[model samples]
Target chain A: MQRVSQRPTYKTIVSVAAAVAIVAVILALGAQKNFGPQQYGQLVVAGLGAGAIYALIALGFVMVYTVTGIINFAQGAFVMLGAMIAATIYGDASSGDAVGLVIAAIIAILATTLVGVAVERLTIFPARNADTLTLIIITVGVYIAIQGVGLVVWGTSAKAFPAFTTLDITDGTLRFWGIVLKTQTLWIWGTTALVLALLTLFLGRTLTGKALRACSVNKEAARLMGISPTRMSVFAFGLAAGMGALAGIVLAPATRPIYDMGLKLGLKGFVAAAMGGLVSSPAAVVGGLLLGLTENVAAGVTKSGLKDVFAFIVLIAVLLRKRGIFAAGTDLERP
Target chain B: MAADSYRSDTGTTTAPAGNGKESAPRRATMAGVVVLVALVLAIGLLEAFQPGGVDVSSLTGGVITFDTTVRIGILTIVVVGLNLLMGYAGQVSLGQAAFFGLGAYSSAIFTTRAELVGIGSGLEGRWWWPWLVMVLGMALTGALAYAVGRPILRLRGHYLAMATLGLGVMVTIMFRENLGLQLDTKDITGGSDGIPGIPRLRVGTFEIWPIERYYYLVWFLAIVGILLALNVVRSRSGRALRALHSSELAAETVGVDTARFKVRALVVSAMYASIAGSLFAHFRVAVSPTPFDFLASLELVVMAAVGGMASVWGAPFGVAAILAIRELVRTRLDLVIGGAGGEQEAVAFGVLLVLVMIFMPEGVVVRVKEVARRWSR
Candidate 1:
């Protein structure tokens, strides 16, 4: 029986290897046929920008999942809320008021943070002892409700959000050797870096952050030490939401803000977080960047429409690999 | 002997000693028969009322339209399968809608574009073609589920959820992009506009139509689906599934092939969704990617959750409750809120799902049953 079981594992490894080889060959051939060096460079840059936003959203996922052991599906909705609220507050895109944009961004982050806290308190906290499946479904419910609220508030039409600054560059874009970089891309990357740095300091240096880390490591132990798991869970959700909102506002100019954009963005963020085994924040950031890069490059090489398919493919592949590539023997929490 | 031991074990551990073990199946059968009769009576009465120019919508205040009833019946089939997988087997497939889409697209593509796929023109409009397509779709979907579930079901909780969700999104993308086939030349799946002019199901010379007949057909299949599910719940395999749901290690220790059972549950559920999808395609006279998207998958989950996940009978109730709520919101919300644009139903569903799972995770049906039992005592 043991030998029989071992054979399928061997078969799985062979099949996975073949699949990877085939994908690599296809990507290479497609790149060779379609993209010049500069085009490749352009795709990479665009991928990095997108990856930065995914990273921030993924950071929120990592925070919530580690502390609460719940994969908050509504994390993406925070991004949507942030973008929609900021766009609403910033008023008409033609105005291009930088100060208004800044204020809108701040207010959006704050409001989204509160929304996140409320979601945790009202939905998650009450059902803290529910099974993982129930809790997961509850988060899904929260996501659906939040998204519905978004639709009622913003309507179905996509809203335009002006770039933070053009950097005085022509057409709000920089070109070098046929590679175009939008000024908004720089903002996304910069904001992502700042958030990451701040998160590192906060998690590493502060007492509250240390307490949050303690709870994630062992909730019972932390509780024994007088740290309230409830308080940390709320804080984690609020902080995650704020980060998600920031990512959303930063990337809003590039990808038009819409009512339902959260689903895709949130799923991609999940893919990123999953790549990190849903526990490691730094690993999640790296995973986000890698996911962004691969998705763009693959989409650029193949059909652009298959871009969404690539993220999911990556997700399934990572999941199948399980303890092989991303994290070593995490053994995800069983229901 | 194994069955006896399992029965005694469950009796001792889960239920009251003797009568609870025996009466449960009997009660389930009685409930199933009652539901089946009620559905048949409702269909006949509705059909009878049709000739008298009786507005069926007036009877139910427009909440239970014939069209909505058909949809509810179709969704009930899907939710029955979902209940088996999630409630009994304790496995989650967030992408059940993908299987539903697969079934739908299979019927749509083969039926609408029979000649394009190299089928003989003679078979294109034949009465048996759609039936053959639906069965084949179920087979294909089951095979796909088996292949996918083997690796995916190994991941426990969040990983499983994410993987299934990804599978669903990927399938939706495929449907939207016409499965990567060129839209300009061989527009087979019809891309985003979806395939229209799908033929109605026919029984030799008689065609099922006028929405009322289709409701009968849908409910007929839904009842069969529910009965099959109920039987599964009472069978040895069902006991094994429930055991697995409670504890995989314990189930394995008791000699249940846990992995195979999980895969089987997934395959069965996928096949159920496929048949329902085929019915939906034929009924709607069109197959679109929109109805089978991620949100649709979530809606199916919501139905299962709302009706009571653990009970096969909860499937129809859940579907009806959700559809009724949606219809209520759609018709009345605009009047109440002023300029409500049909998006509030999602909000209502979302809130309902959260509230139900939080308060009564076993589902409303089970909760009501418990409450009733307590009151009777």
Candidate 2:
């Protein structure tokens, strides 16, 4: 114990050990549930796809919160803007091609990143001296503004992604030992994983990523070491917006991007961010996918239909637990 | 600037009762006189103009029919209560619509049921019973807010916002699903169709049916509400709220009971919403869950913030202005904007919110004050 206490980075090693054990348990239990090979396989693909989008938006939310010291209520609005612009540019109001969609989505992401920077630079920077409540009010005001803008541009009607054909060699079911996997779900799993793995690497190995993480943890020390927080904040916002645009694109097919989609998506992302303590990026990625799964699974089990009630139940449980809301003041006890 | 302590992370805080600080010799009559004059003008002008009716024809005409305006006016009062809670008090509550709905439904039931069960059988409750029901209903709702406030208020920022959002949604679901609360053995809430034919209000022999009459009544209520909110804002408790709004630590260190203040603010806001709802119940004679939702709550928040959160009188003006804008945007601009058939309003609302945040963060009140300052010279 004395030696352990004397060790410089003992807590860090312990954290890793705990993380591994918890992951191992979750995997073991996840494998034993209703999630058979087909379900498990589908969960991975679909989960990752959804997770990637959530990860990006969630990262943006956390990043903004890190520097501004408050949540950006407009983040989801930014996501919607990204998706809507992509949809519009990818095709005329009348129609579009495959390449057009891809190009438009990329442009939307890039453009929105600039928007992210501009918002932080102009709207947020001026009010850094304001109180938190004032800051919150400012953000809420921004949120309404974004919503209004969307309403003017897109109207209340829901927009649809271009039609697509499903390609499944197994024909909607991959039949191996009575387990069936859908092709679309399969794609989501792969894409999300690749992106998340890349993000993990970026945070661990890259200079920009390190700077962002460092700034998030300790802004003053980072500034002392010559990191331009303003630039980093903008960079973080850009990365998050780009990711949000991606999330919007991926999600559009499922929920169909509506003017109101941002509110719900933003709320869910906030939930996931809070659920993971807003400290762990990996946890957030997993947390978001799990939240989606939790809702769907709860709906399946209860049959009451998980629309409004499901979110409240999870939120209430998470909130009132003995360990502060989102595990505040309590260390994450790894299983 | 101490960057080390300047962490973005938020935590739950223990708020204390307000610091009782008086800035000026009590200009008590400035507020009182304003309410009295606004009331007399609102009522006297309507009667002088002879704005009367439930008639659809008059409503269709371009004239400012007294009835609809008054009903909307009353709704504004309820929203004012909501605004004070959200705007000045620094608490986000989405359950006002539910409280308003409940108040409207209960008040309707109180008066109508009294008329039905006791037709001079001595059990005939006082005509003012509806008023009682309104207060009781609002109080009960305020109690609900308090109950919801305790744990829910423990949430920080967005978490609180979403939780309040969840609360609003669940309450809507409850109103839709719960059978015991319905009227006449029908879904009586009429569910999606909404409850129409809400009985009109009566004050001593003055049969309040015309929107014009209700308009005066509502404005009267609104004036009262504004005054009440102003009192709350200027009160010792209001200061604590402002303190908590800035820094909970700073506020608590100064000996303010933050939790109690939050609860008080929430309850007071609910009461305001309840009063407004009661007026709405009598005026429109209709109430719907649809009108009171997350969007409604958001709109109220926007109204308060738009007018200026720090401004005492801005809440009422904000509600009045937003409603007027909605009417105008839908009516005056209908032809120009393809018969109001597009996402014009929503887009405008979003843009307005953004613009306010970006341009006038102090809200319209501050700008108005600035103009007044310049003009006074």
- Please provide, for model 1 over B83-146, each residue's C-alpha lDDT reduced to its tens digit, 9 standing for 90 to 100: 8999888888799999999999999988988777778778877898999999999999999999
lDDT minimum window of 10 residues, candidate 2 chain A: A326-335
lDDT of 1: 0.85
lDDT of 1 by residue, A1-335 (tens): 12335455766799799979966875686767776678878889999989988988999998998898888999999999999999898876445466777889999999999999999999999988788778889999999999999988888999877877851213288888889999888888888888888888999999999999999899999999999999999999999999999989988889889999999999999888888777877788888998999899888887789999998898888887774245342555443
lDDT for each of the candidates? 0.85, 0.62
Query: What tens-digit string does per-residue lDDT give for candidate 2 at A165-199?
Result: 23111224355555444444444455456667787
Model 1 TM-score (2 dp):
0.93
lDDT of 2 by residue, B1-377 (tens): 11111111001122223344632313333654476567557545645655664333244454334444564566666666765566555666645676666676666555554444233423224556667678777878888888988887766555566567777766776555532242455454455556666556677667775555665667777777766676666668767877776666688999999888887887887787777777777776776667676677677767766666555456556665776666656656767765564356665665566567556666776677667769999
Q: What lDDT score is found at residue B63 in candidate 2?
A: 34
Please state every model's RMSD to the true fold in angstroms.
Answer: 4.5, 7.9
DockQ of each: 0.53, 0.23
Task: State the lDDT at B21 in candidate 1.
Answer: 53
TM-score of each: 0.93, 0.77
